[model samples]
Target: MELTVLGDNAAQNSAGGGCSAGSCGSTDHQVSHLPDHIREKVENHPCYSEKAHHYFARMHVAVAPACNIQCHYCNRKYDCANESRPGVVSEVLTPAQAVKKTMVVAANIPQMTVLGIAGPGDPLANPEKTFETFRELSEKAPDIKLCVSTNGLALPDAVEELAKHNIDHVTITINCVDPEVGAKIYPWIFWNNRRIKGVKAAKILIEQQQKGLEMLVARGILVKVNSVLIPGVNDEHLKEVSRIVKAKGAFLHNVMPLIAEAEHGTFYGVMGQRGPSPEELSELQDACAGDMNMMRHCRQCRADAVGMLGEDRGDEFTMDKIETMEIDYEEAMVKRARVHAAIAETLAADHAKVSAPVMTVAAGTRPVQMAVATSGSGVINQHFGHAKEFLVYEASPNGVRFIGHRKTDQYCIGDDTCGEKESSLTTTIRALEGCEAVLCSKIGFEPWDLLEAAGIQPNGEHAMESIEEAVAAVYLEMAKAGKLEQAVITAAA
Candidate 1:
């Protein structure tokens, strides 16, 4: 294991290199808090920066299909296209194939900046295929930021190789530090040519994870810790995990919900281990926020996911499609550079023009949750009828925070009499049950009335406006008009 430092030339030429200050977005408070060096690493990396997710896109190549640890929450499924979760991919590619797909995605999706290898299995467990892909990408696509997500069972050994390829970002899924709680989440781990099960395995895995985290941080590589919040399993235990990882110098902490739906067929899912409720997850994140930066916008993306967060475009660049289509790496890289520059310019302009509203709310006003319909780019531009999902935000006098998103059936299918329109609208409203307001570009008369009747305000006044600003402005309006107090009392009643 030979450690190497990222060169100055590579840093300057990386995809995030040339972006102006505030180019990521207006709500980039996490990035703003970072020191200049670490800030440069995450300002344009979509997964690392919540605000950058709107402007930049990331893709994961599924080249590693081997695992060293067995987690109760994960069941890696290949050829699983319909499911959108970690460890699920339609296909696994060889190192060469992964590089080719990376090139094609970069060429096609100009906003794509970060290329990660978060597998159908662990990248560090399959070090040969993993590092080979990274080696090639660093040579061919040096401008694209490279990252890897591992279970950390093999991370201590891979850190040197990771740094050798100029890979600056690493994600370690550290579910629990206590072996007792860990034994509940991970059943077995293959270590030292033998299968270790139960508490012994959990202890080794935890030790490796903590050591790898410290090793990566010592080398100046940005580390983001991902924890799955299982209701009875590790919910309360993750706070200590967060505190420990932050103490080890992890740059960010992402506390994601466990996807234990029985349909996924994992051990937890089949055994009726339920995931945390949205409220529970939010409370845990808030608790951990006192320790370090909490990542709220994770989509728990697939191994081969393409495009932005909350969206997948992997179907467009399948192996068959890549074989048929011709790609000119040099030319595409030039075009990508230009597109990134243009995006930075646009974001800078948007930030300068739209100042965040100042809200003078009465004391003790509860935070209001609002849903915004947006196709992408962090604006309230999507029409109500056209939205397949609504981005939910919680606005307080402190600031606006993206809590989660609610998926709903599309309301306005092209005019086929809309036979199921009423049912769809009902379901959509039900999905947005807690939200007090829905902001979008337009809403029809019928749905508008229905939303109002349900105590959810439908407002189209802030079309094409920044989502954070619009949410805050709406909250201020509600506070000024005495709606906040009434809503709280009504809910109480």
Candidate 2:
């Protein structure tokens, strides 16, 4: 894998590209501990000044309905005035048309400096439109900064093209660092050699993305990570995500709220629930304040937004709007998918799909799970310990129940940021040893495999946030089924 990391050197916590990694010596937040290359990028960000950041400098043009990942929290079939949705097409502009529209809009509102393609479809999933827009803008309007948000499937190749056009900012939507959560979000991915489904597909994507981010950062591209704070899925994982991205070179962190619009039929709200409120977002920002720059001015615009923050350039975004555009949503979705597949084939050094272990739950417990890491990122101490004992596994009475993890040492021991965490695959298998089931917020490639090896079956996605609630829920469910003994036995075992 050609590892090129993308991150904002100017905004990083470390300093100097060649500095030896160590405890960040400075307590200063204004001056970055990140290497000089990355530090400069953050320092130089045009948005650094309060006067430069007005809500309207960027726009999301949702041109297609195709996306590679189905985030448990997303339904691309809808539209949000603030968040990214699947079906809402303000308009589906061809690359040429998009460029033309952007130029035209720029004339009316010159404050717009960033032209971003966030999308009803993943930008990478629509490479032709994504890149072509960049190509056109480069030739027509060189002053505007080019930005794109993607699943990172096509990023490895797209980065080179973007850099060629002097593009500076990029956003990648990363949720959980685990794979089981990924399976819940993504059904299939054209990864490795063949198309993989469920957990395998998720693993491939996470790895590819981690690799791609590194490549992007190494080349001086600025990366802002958009992490949806999915409560039960990866809420606790935020601090870790911030740490890793900061280390790898991400500049700004955009922790967006999971907008669960009922009409969308996407996630969380299926239970007729609401997402985290503004207060919750504040707490999360406080929690993630460990040397990471968090994005506070997110309007969560649709993929195809046009105009300045205060200005209503809504007309510039008139591509997929049924009232104005002629393109069908389904057709645009198909085109987007084709572009995504093509981009994946263009990037990613092909690898094989690694098989994982398949352990079952004991009689009344959740399955034992494992955490997979990207290269270089080894096991973080964040693994839930007796924390595993708290997750309740819901299965048929006749279905197997996961007992518990016998070990926690190497179970969480592995690189999450670097791809070498594969070695921990062996460690994970051994950690689960006699365990029959697994419990986790998410899973990734190799760790997914290890849990399978130890006979641990994935319990799938869970909504447990606090460590205690997860454990208590397990026993509560077992007791309700008159199977609490299994929990006791597992505790003893």
Candidate 3:
């Protein structure tokens, strides 16, 4: 049978076979350049100041795109689900050839510590190709780590083979433990040369997969689980996977964001109609956190990616490279002019105006925009003296602050000042009215509407606990870039 490889999506946690062909980097692109204001805004985002906080340290190469089982949600037309999981296959390679591609990648990226085989198909289902490549790599480049992600349908049979090859890590995509929901996602399971479904097949598959995880871990292999955080399909099941796999010795839990691949010819389009929001994604991650390490930095690289941070690799990747040379002295460069364009367009607008990009609430929905308010002759209320329920999850530049209700202390506006305003619904609304954005655990609709109307951006989607801390991050970044004095809020107040 002919095999095809489709690039992986967002971060390779889901979509297709997890090759992430869609998000691959350009071989010789330039670093994305941002305007001063946009750069300041970008710096405020955690990725810039504390990137280590969200990095995943592995890479993948797509070898096979064929699957033995037909999942209700399964769309194996593409070799990888990453870029657009259900698209037509763009590239395909055998395991030996895939390894050669990976070695070329390892040379350019020293931090790419682990190598994985994810596919257009189930990695274990194509055991010979998967293990054959692993065996070859073991002999040619013994120092590099080997990893594989599978559907778990064929995992039990491939366990010994993987162990024999000294494979160190594995990522399995298990959505639900219950057969009812399982049936919706998985159409038919091949067992005994017959198609099985309902609870029987689900039970058999989950049991064997779980047992295989135990066996693999028993052999001293590290296990990582990639669970899709699909809202209704198996939202609650995530906690269970975390609980079960953690018990079975899985070390890392990568709760991936589901890609809503439009027009990728597949059953998923007919099965589901939407994708998860940033807020919803955070909710699953928060709910699923447990003893298992959660991987946040998954770039979901392509099956042939060869640079750190999913930066593009030039022509360095090939089937021959896998036989030798695990590291590349020079890294590949990426050009991000388009990404920079988006950032600049949003930032250069007057922060004070309620523009299209500005924070603004729609007629019927929640605050749909970040209305950039007007800079006024009236005194600026940077800090609302009224301290309400404040909670700080992480540390920030501004000393300790609250995420819940508290008494407001510092009123920086001109003297003859208003006493510390009581932390009330009115005060919350007033505070958000003046601030560009507010990041908190939750907010009331009353305050949300007021903030949007008054030109404040409600950063309600983030799961962070500290607002001042994030603000401080923005401050420090501007300071380091030599733009702080003019760009930052003054302490004199």
Candidate 4:
């Protein structure tokens, strides 16, 4: 198979080129984190600032109903009035209908400060539908902040498109970074026109997630990571999730317990996989306090959730009201499509110069394994502790061939940011034991020493290079330093 690798620099340079006026990659948060200035900006966003919950309100319009992946805990077709979880929207509207509903809701509830799309499906999956809605809102209701919640599989490619529409806040549902746990939570993901199952799917999903988060942060987008705390699965791992995303510059972390109600017709619910208790959830949030800010006011909202945090105004703006409401659909569609096409054209022209790298890895004299922490643009970019997975390649006399990856557990244990504790630290070292060398953007002294103590060469000083570029450099250096031959002898020992 031929190799195609998009360069890392293209992503960093391509951001914010088409953002709407006055919001060219600017964040609303102030210098002092959640101080008065920041609060005023986020005072109406119920999900981001805790103090905004009581007086502020938010609304989600479920315009995108097509999904690309299947979550074991989600059933999009089944919506119970008694149940409240993701994929349960009372009504799904078109881009035109959504804007009309937003107008009605905003007028009815003056407290509404933000408009979001947390889908009956992945918003990024239905990009045209989702962006069209944003285009209309940006022209009509520019004052209200626009937010979106996505699974992150398509986010890496969609960041430029999102910034073009001036999307201010984004929420990514990052359940777990470890694919062993991820394989249990997600059944399959449809990618590259194929349905990839098991750990392979999980790894691809994770790499895109970490990469997208980094790109969004670089573009000054306020990111909120939502982790569903599944008891006996990933409850204990969430604090580490918090640490890693915080390290990567996520603005906020919202850890919500899994809502596994049997009436919702979910796979986990049928299997009796229970959600964390209130106490269990609270303790996990408390454990993540010092390492990152935790959002305690999440109501585990539905896709069509409306009104304040605890209340529901979805019934007030139902399809009946939207039909009765007068709107210029033809004009709205024309404006939405016109702006969208123009921005897309400008973005295309701006990125027309970016090209993919001719990636290749040569064979070495002796067999050895190498790993890299990447943002999936084929470059070493992510911090050691924040790496979602390490791409492992086997170099032998025949040739260097793609092998597999080890989903690294986010390195911090409990509340320890530096990873000084021996237990979680030992687990990480053991996972990468036989690798001769590992390429990373940065690592702390304790973990660096730990890898060297285990005889794995830690190459923390390597500058940003593509996976092919880094592998070639490392292979040649190993050959010159006689490390590959020594590795062979050590294996014979």
Best by lDDT: 1
User: Candidate 1: deviation at residue 248, Å?
Assistant: 0.5
Candidate 4 off by > 4 Å: 1-32, 35-40, 326-493
TM-score of each: 0.89, 0.55, 0.56, 0.60
Which RMSD does model 3 reach against the true structure?
18.6
Q: Tens digit of lDDT per residue, candidate 3, span 240-337?
A: 87767766666556776655443443466555546566456545664554233344434444554444332434235545444465543223212122
Over 152-185, each residue of candidate 2 has an lDDT whose tens digit, in order, gives 8767867778788777778887775677777765
Best of the two (3, 4) by TM-score: 4
- For candidate 4, the 10 contiguous residues with the lowest summed lDDT are 21-30
Candidates sorted by TM-score, best first: 1, 4, 3, 2
Model 4, residue 10: distance off in Å is 35
Which sections of candidate 3 miss by over 4 Å?
A: 1-58, 78-89, 290-292, 310-472, 475-493
Q: Write the per-residue lDDT of candidate 4 for residues 1-493, one digit (tens) a residue.
A: 1111111123422432321111111111111234343344554477875434534678999999999999988987686554456788777899998988887776666567789998999999999999999999999876668999999999999999999998868999998888998899899999999999999999999889999998998887778899998998888778778878877878677888777766556888778999775447656765664455566557766788888665567887897976786755445545544543554354334235322222232343666678777653335776787665576655554334333345454223354432345665676677675687888999888888988888888887664765545665677777777765543553443
Q: Which residue pairs of candidate 4 clash?
A: none
Candidate 2 matches the true fold with a TM-score of 0.55
lDDT of 4: 0.70
Q: How does residue 6 of candidate 3 score in lDDT? A: 16
CA shift at 435, candidate 2, in angstroms?
49
Every model's Cα RMSD, please?
A: 7.0, 20.6, 18.6, 19.0
